[model samples]
Target: MTEQTTGRLKVRLVDGLLILIMAVLAGCGLIYEYLLSHYAGRVLGAVEHAIFATIGIMIVAMGFGAFAARKIKDAFSGFAWLELYICFIGASSILFIAAAIGFTFHLPQLISDTFNLPADVLPRGGWVEQLHQIARYLPYVSAACLGFFIGIEIPLIARVREALYQKHLTHNAGTVYGADYIGAGIGAALWIGWMMSLDINQAAVITASTNLLIGFLILLLFWQKIRWRLLLTACQLLMLAFVIVLSAYGQNWMNSFTDMLYRDQVVLQQQTQYQQIVLTERNLQLNNNPTQTSVLQLYLNGRLQFSSMDERIYHEMLIHPVMASAPKHDSVLLIGGGDGLALREIFKWPVHSVDMVELDPMMISLFKQPRQFLPIRLAKQVIELNANSLSDERLNLMYADAFNQVDQLVAQGRIYDVIVVDLPDPNHPDLNKLYTNHFYTRLQQLLNADGVLVVQSTSPYHAQDAFIAIGKTIADANFSAVEQYHQNVPSFGQWGWSVAVKQGLPVSERLKHSLAAQTMPVIKTQWLTWPIVLASFNFPQGFYKNYVNIKVNRLGSQQLFNYHDQAWRKQQGMVNLNSNQQISP
Candidate 1:
């Protein structure tokens, strides 16, 4: 081959490798952003806000990173270093955040042990609270770091490509940016289709490995021109080895760190496509006896779903009021109670058929097929708690979004005597739709003529505006009558529910008459009785009188989400204020 032809071929090879690296790095960068946001939402307790804020901050940081890339004189070495930093930070970000939060959670105990002070006497508004505030920012900090490195990548790669060509490429920006955007699209698909199925830490390690490989490829392709070739290669190899080791033991490290975040031991933890599922167990001994009482608690995205000790109170209250008030209980529709506790209550009646729609199949499986690794007693506790309700022959379980499923049911001409909405609170914006008038109106269509519907509203005391808005929204759905009730379950204080019946039928009169007619419940309940059912509808005077002018939740406005967020913030503020007051001299 001629010398000129050989030079041209070498340039082509360098350009091809650089472009390919750009695409792969783009995919890795986007996944790192998603991982940070997902972890933030899981640890911080507000999924919607955490995700939005993390993405927003990362985008801004990306802009800063692109601007900073202009100062790099050597694109090849800069891009290589950027990959190493991104790999290190992205892979270890979650573990670092988990460790920080875990340390903060145990800070008070650490202080108690270090100084030999009584736990109760530790200063409530001291280092522990400050550490918590700092921990909350860790996710954002990690995101910015990842974004800055990712921001530097494309520009650096473009410069290197231009240098290799020895001429200014006509569509340099378009080529670089097009590859990045397309690669990000592929990354999102991989995340949803495959990566999400793995444990979060494993996914992070995989992305980190991709990043390390890209750095090594860049070093190898430009070895003749690059400085410190051996040192850079060694560093990349060390990082790759470390990431591989982390992937093998990441779950155990995560579990140990996560265990520190909770008061109870984390017996089981899984990252499903939708959310993180964690099961915690605590053993309590009565009067120092050898026999211990085990409490199994289920948490979704770090929000407690139910505790074994007092779930009966929550489930019974959720199911019975609507069932007893309905004209018939032969057919029932349950939404979002995947744990089967609600179904257990429904099975008590002579219901011939039951339909349940839960969004997460993993949640259902966890309850259906108890894991052997779980403490046998704790695993059995869940089965006993749900009473193996899913195993019943009459249940028609559907794993799908309840909102969409309810709409389809309407199209199918399906109707139910009692519809129990046992979903979690409208804490996230996605969940806000389920609590909106739009969803409830569709639900109203699916109810039988004399049917009754009950919704598990949030806490009446803590989230009063949210609770009241839920009732108002249900009434706006054209239900003839609506009533709100609450019960104090030890696990959750002052929890509430809203019940609605067909238009023109008084829910109170039906409930009263139903209780008076039936001297005893058809099925026995541990906490619910006829008298308690009657009393639930009777709140103290002026309990809701102050909540006038509360807007009904609508799909477009999402008033419930705002009210819910504000109420929880206020509740948290009051708790902190109370703690400060109690600890003050």
Candidate 2:
């Protein structure tokens, strides 16, 4: 080959490698951003807020990183070292955050064990609490560090491309940026398509391993251009070994850390596409003997769904009131009760068919056909707990988001005589949509003219405004009548529900007449009685008097979620209740 031709080919090869490196690094960087955000949401209570905050912090840090990359005098060495740092930080970030949060969570127990102090008697709301609060936010710090390194990548790649060509190419920035954007798009697609459902540690290891491989390629292909070839290669090998170990055992370590966050024994835990499902058991002891009745509690994304001991109270109240009040019980629609506990109650009525729209099919599978991963005894208990309602011949299960599924039912003109919304509290914006007046309005259209619709409103005492707003939203959906009721369930203190009818006598009056006429006797319930049902409709005077500023949860407004989050934070002491700047629950 001629001298000029050889020189041009060399430049082309170097340019291609640099662009490829930029693309791969971009993909890795995007995955790291998602990883940190997802972990933050899992640890923090507010999933949406945590995700947005983490991404925002990372993006701002990236801008600062891009600006700061001008400080690197040796582009080749700087880019290589930056990849190493990114690899180490990305691989270890989640584990480090988990360890910090778990240590802080278990600190009280550690102190009590060391000092022989009673658990409740230990000091609180001091340095320990401060440590807990600080630990909760470690994800943001990790995010900033990772994002800073990721930000330097494109600038270094551009510099290397220019140096390889022996001239500053006008298209350098545009070309490198195009590759980076395309790689990031691919990363996003991978995350949504596959990585989202993988074990989080596994995802981290895979991303880090990709970074390590890219760094190795750079060190090998540009040995003379980059300094510290031997050290970088050694570091690459070491990081590869570390990633392998993490792949083998990191999820176990993560589970141990996660177990520290819970008070009871975490018997079963799974990360599904929708949310984290944790099943915990509290073995009660009376007179130093283990009692036969152990409490099995189900939690979705760290929020308690139900405790087996008092779930009857919650479920009976959620189901029986609306069932009795409805003029007919031949058809029913249930939204978001994948556990089948509510379905078990629905079966008590004389419903000919039940159509359930649950967002998570894994939840349905877990309850319907308990997986072998669950302990055999516990699996049997789960099936028995729900009476295998998921597998019943009357059930027509639709594994889809209720927000969209409700619309389809409306389009099909499929109306239900009774509809039960057994969804979770509106902790995330996606869930907040379900609480909007638009959602309730669509649901109103899906209900028979005289049918009853009931929702599992949040706690009456803990989140009174949120509960009231839910009732108001349903009322605003053009229901003919609406009534709010509460029952003190031990698991969830003072839980509430809202019942509405499209056009008929109100649910409470219908329920009262049903009780008086002896027509509701067919419903055999363990925890529900006539007086309890009737009295649930009664609230302490003035409970409904202070809602002057409450607004109906409209589309995109998320008022119900705001109320619930504010109230919950106040209850958890996360909000400063005594300050003038404090938001009212």
Candidate 3:
């Protein structure tokens, strides 16, 4: 071969290697973004805000990093060091955030234990509060640091390419960025398709491992131009060993960190596509011996769903009122009760068939069938708690989003005698949609003329305005009768529900008629009685009478989410109330 041909081939090989490095690093950068945002959302309790805010902070930091990259005189060494920093930070970021938040969560208790303080005597709204606020924001801080490193990549890569070719290429920026964009697209696809469902620590380690590998490749290909070649290789090997250990034991360490956040012992925790599901167990000690009737609690996305000690109260109250009030119990539609506790209550009546729509199949499967993944004792307790109601042949489970499922049901002209909505609180915009007037209207189409619909509204005492807005939103859907009621569940204080009748008598009157008729057998329950069911309809005077201009939660306007967020923030002392904003009449 001619000398010119050999020289050209060498330059081309160097150029191709640089582009490939950029593409893989771009993928790693995107995964780091998702990993931080998802972990923040899970721990912070405001999923939507945490995810979006973290991403926004990271994007701005990336811009800053790009501008600052010009300060580095040696592009080859700079790019190599940038990958090392990103890898280390990305791998350990989740663990650091979890520890910070977990410490803040346990700080009050630690202070109480140290000083022999009573339950109500601990400190509030001082350094303790400041620490908590700071801890809650650690994820964003980590995002900024990681994003800064990621931003340095493109500029340094372009500089390194020019240095390798001995001249500035006019299209260098465009070519490098094109590879970046394509790699980012692939990263997003992997996150949505597979990585989201994996253990969070594993995902972080995998992304970090890719960065470490790419950094080693850079060290091999450009040894002469790069400084501290031996040290750089050693650092890469050390990082690779650290990542290997993280892949093996990181999840167990993560669980220990998370376990500090809960009062009870966390037995099983899993991350599904939809949300994080955690099961905790509290033992009742009788003379230092654990009782057989221990309490099991289910939490979704850091919010408690139900506790075994008092779940009977919640499930019975949710199911029996509507089931008893409806004229027929042959067919029913249940939305969002994936736990199967409500189904256990419904089966007490002579219901012929039930169609349940739950968005998360993992939730249903956890309660329905035994799996080898769960500890043997937890599996038994979970299945027996709901009395294995999910395995009954009468259940027709449809794994679908309730919003789209209701629309399909309306289109199919399906009718039900009773419809129960046992969903989580409206802490997110997607959940707010399910509580909107448009959604209720679609559900209204699926009910028979005399059928009843009951919704699990949030707490009347803590979130009075949100509770009121939900009832008003349902009434705006044009139901004949709408009434709000409340009961105290120990795990969740002062919970409430709203019942609506399509036509004829209201829920109270229909329930009274059902009680008066003696032909059917009395439906027995642990927590609900005839008088208690009737009394739940009677709230404190002026509770439902809203004097302020509280608007209905339409589809687009997230008024309900705003109300719920503000109410809870005020309750936690995170926000100062405005004199103009009165939730209760």
Q: What is the C-alpha lDDT profile of model 2 across 291-351, one tens digit per residue?
A: 3656888888777788888899988898988988887889999998899999999998888
Runs off by more than 4 Å, candidate 2: 285-291, 574-585
Q: Which lDDT tens digits does candidate 1 get at residues 371-398?
A: 5546676667678889999889999999
- How many backbone overlaps does candidate 3 show? 0
lDDT of each: 0.83, 0.85, 0.86
TM-score of each: 0.95, 0.95, 0.93
Model 1 ranges off by over 4 Å:
286-292, 371-373, 518-520, 546-548, 576-585
Q: lDDT tens digits, residues 1-585, model 3? A: 999999999989989988988888888888888989888876665667888998898889999999999999999888887788888999998988888877876787788899999987766457886787788789999999998888989999999999888898999999999999999988999999999888888899999988888888888888898999889888888998889888888989999988887879998788987887888888875776734667888888777888899999988898888887888988899998898999999999999999999999999988887555467767787788898999989999999999999999998999999999999999888899999999999989899989999999999989999999999999999899998888888778788999999898898887777678753348888878878978988888887677367789999899999999888677756331111011110
**Where does the lowest 10-residue lDDT sum fall in candidate 2?**
576-585
Error of 3 at 152 (Å): 0.9
Off by over 4 Å in 3: 111-125, 285-291, 370-373, 516-521, 545-548, 574-585
Candidate 3's C-alpha lDDT?
A: 0.86
lDDT of 1 at 113: 92
Flag the better candidate by TM-score, 2 or 3. 2
